[model samples]
Every structure is written in C-alpha cells, then in structure tokens.
Target: MKCIIVNDDSEMRKTIGKLIGHSRGMKLLSVFNSTSEAALFLRDNCVDLVFFDIQMYDVKNLEFIQNISERTFVIYIPEFSPFVNTTKKPQLEQLSESTIAKRFKKGVDEARIFLKLIKKEKPDILDDYFVI
Candidate 1:
C-alpha cells in the first residue's frame, strides 16, 4: 500500500518510516514534517495509507486527516510513545501461542469494526495496524 509519514519530529518520522519500510505489505511514498505539506500532496495524489502523528504543530492532525479524502487510511501514532526496552524482549518472546492468538484476535476485531464503518461509506480503504 502507498503510505506517507507525517510527524513534526524528524527522528520520530525516521523511526516510523523505517518500520513502514520493513513491513512486507506497505510502500512508503514520502515523509512530511508538517500537516500543510502533507495536505497539499494529498490534494492530487491517491495514497492508500498515512502513518500520521497524533500530535503535530499548529495544525491539528486529526482535523487535517478529516480534510483529506475519507478513502485514505490513517494509523495514528500518539505522542505518548510506548517505551519498549530490550528487557521486554525476552518476556515478549516467552508469550504462549494462545496469548499471541488472543492479541491478534483483539486487533482483528477492532479492525473489522473500523473497516465496517469505511465499507459503509468509502468502501475502498482497508488498512490495518497495531497501535502501541
């Protein structure tokens, strides 16, 4: 899917962009430091997804998202970033299959509900992501 990263913080933008690049199902189109730049780009482009920062300068990210075509899917990364340290890796790795399955199911259920709303309206944008 074609995607863009919009974040005021350059480092945050890079981090999210790298994650998107590593994802097997996404295509990173471009990265923007401000909402206006991204808004202008979207005026004439058909982007499938946008990795948007929940907190952006001056312009409200949510409002900016609303102005765009509803056909676009946005995965909002809140400013309160989750600090996942190396210490958590071992514990996470020890998760049982059922535990993993439960988490996956919860994510899928939320996505299904969101998609249902979109399908009733745009019916075109179907993207999913885990909000940490």
Candidate 2:
C-alpha cells in the first residue's frame, strides 16, 4: 500500500515512515513536515493510506483530511485522539503504538490483535491479499 506521514517533527515523520516502510505490504511514498505540503501533494495524486498526526505545528489534522476525502484511507496517530467515534467511521482503525520500537517490535499477540482489528475495520485494504 502507498502511504505518507505528516508531522511537524522530522524525527517523528522518519520514525513513522520507517515503520510503514518495513511493514509487510506497505510502502512509504513520502513524509512531509507540513500539512500544506501534504495537502497539496494529495490534491493531484493518489495514496492508499495516510498516517497523519493530529497535532501538527500549523495545521488541523481533521480539517486536512476532510479536504482530501477522495476514497483515501486515513489512520490518525495522535497523543490524545478520541477513539470513541472511530467505530462510526467506515475503514477507520485506531493505532495505539506510541513509539517506533513499540510498533516495530510489537509482540505476535499484539500484532495479531492489531491486524485483526484493521482487517475487520478495513477489509478493502486486504481484499487482494490472501493474508497480511
């Protein structure tokens, strides 16, 4: 899957990009520190998934995603994001890993649970693969 990371912190963006890059079926297309840059890029391009930070230095995450509602899947990675409303959004899944190590070295059980939740919530992302 083609993916991008949007965060003001360059280190955070790289960390997240590495995780996505190392994933089995995911590709890190690009990482941007500004939402405006990401937004402009998304306007004329297509991405399979967007991993966005809720609190960017100069942008509102929700507003940016709202402006790009063109069949792209979004996964919010925020410190204080609310999951209470995630269940109501189609193909939305809450990722709780707060650190690169936690995401990259997650245990099999945790990975299994995360994968199951993602598959159940966003089956279209995995429909072509027999397993992920």
Candidate 3:
C-alpha cells in the first residue's frame, strides 16, 4: 500500500515511516512535518493509506480527512486516547470509539496490524481499526 506520514514531531514521523518501510507490501511515499504541506500533496496525489496526527496547526485534521477520497483509509495518531469526541465529527460517527481507543493505546503494533488487515482487505479484522 502507498502511504504518507504527517506529524509535527520529527521523531514520530521517522518512527512511523520506518515502521511502514519495514512492513511487507507497504510503501512510504512521503513524510510531512505539517498538515498544510500534506494537504498540498494530497490534493494532487492518490494514496492507499495515510498515517497522521489528529492535532495539526491551523487546520482541523477531521476536515482534511473528510475532504479526501473515501477510498483512502486514515489511521489517526491522536495525541491521547479518548481525546476526540467522535460524535461531534460526522465522518467518524459510524466508527466505534472503543476501537479507536484501542488503536491509540497500542501504538506501532496497531499500526502494523492495521496495514496488514488493509492489505488483506479483511473487513472483520479492519472493523477493529476503522470504518472508512
């Protein structure tokens, strides 16, 4: 799967980027330290997966995520577990908050598993991660 990393922390970006690179059947297309740069890149390019932080400068990450094609899956690396109120966001309403919590709590293991499940296209395993 083609992917990108968008995080303000350089270490976080590198860690996630390396995880993607080390994973089988995944490609790290690019990495951006800011959401604005990422948004510019996303406007012209199509990617299979995006791993990004929920808190970004100026832009509301949910709005940016909503603007992207539904075909692309998003895995949010939120600052903390249970931070986002899913009900407030229309795009995230269908997904389970518990699942998102588990993801945020598990770190790299969850990310690796998410990508693997996505690659296999198994909705059952994927149901634990995201809905769309």
Candidate 4:
C-alpha cells in the first residue's frame, strides 16, 4: 500500500517514514508537516493508506480529513487523538506506544492486521460494516 505521514514533529515524521519504508506491503510516498499540505497531495493522487497525526503545529486536521476521499484509509498516529474507536471501519486504527518502536521491526504487523480486517470486513466510509 502507498502511504504518507503527516505530523507536526519532523522527528516523528522521520520515524514513521522509516517505519513505513521498512513495512511489508507498504510504501512511503511522502511526508508532510502540515495537514493542509497533505490534504493538497491527497486531492490529485490515490493512496491506499494515510498515517496522520491528530496533534499538529500549524493547521487542524478536521477540515483536512473531510477533504480526503472516502476510499482512502486513515491510520491515526497519535495516542491522544480525539477520535473514539467505536466505528466498525477496518481502515481506521490507532497506534500504541508499546508497539511503536517494534512496529516496523515486526514487519508492519499492525498494518498487516488492519489490512486483513479491511479485507474481511470491507468497511466503507458511507456505511457501517457491522449491523449487529
């Protein structure tokens, strides 16, 4: 999957970029410090996944998130992000600190797990995947 990292912290961006680079079945497309910049890139291109940071230094991500295509999947990077993981969307998931350092070392296991869920559930943005 083609992906990008958008984080206010350059260090974090670098870290995630390196992780993505080492990830299996994943490619690092680009990295951005601002949500708007990432949003602009998302407009003309197609990416299978996005690694986004909820806490940004310049612009808020709410509008940016709204601007992206529904087909794209979002993997939130911040542990303190505002989103509550109540949805049954297979494309959405949060990163935990315990697994951050070992994420890529484990061959992008988290992303692999999420992608497996996506394949099994096929959750779309417009509709709920689970009805029960």
- The deviation in Å at residue 17 for candidate 3 is 0.8
Off by over 4 Å in 3: 80-132
| Candidate 4 Cα outliers beyond 4 Å, as residue runs | 79-98, 102-126, 129-132
Return the TM-score for each candidate structure.
0.62, 0.58, 0.61, 0.65
Specify the poorest-scoring 10-residue window by lDDT in model 2: 87-96
Q: Which rank order by lDDT, best down to worst?
A: 3, 4, 1, 2
Cα RMSD to native, each candidate? 7.3, 9.9, 9.0, 8.5
Evaluate model 4: give its lDDT: 0.65
lDDT preference between candidates 2 and 3, better one: 3
What lDDT would candidate 3 get against the real structure?
A: 0.67
Q: List the residue pairs that clash in candidate 3.
A: none
**Model 1 over residues 1-132: C-alpha lDDT tens digits?**
677888877766766666566555667888998898898899888886776777676446666877866555566755543334343423333445455445434533454555466767644444443343
Tens-digit lDDT track of model 4 for 1-132:
888888876667776786677656778888888887887898888886777776565556789888766555666666343334554422223545445655434434544555566667666623642110
Candidate 1, 45: how far from true, in Å?
0.9
Model 2: per-residue lDDT, tens digit, 9-126?
Answer: 6656766676666677777778887788898988887776677776666746667867864445556565333534554532222434553346444432333454555657775643
Query: Could you say which candidate leads in TM-score?
Result: 4
Once superposed on the true structure, which residue ranges of model 2 sit more than 4 Å away at CA?
79-132
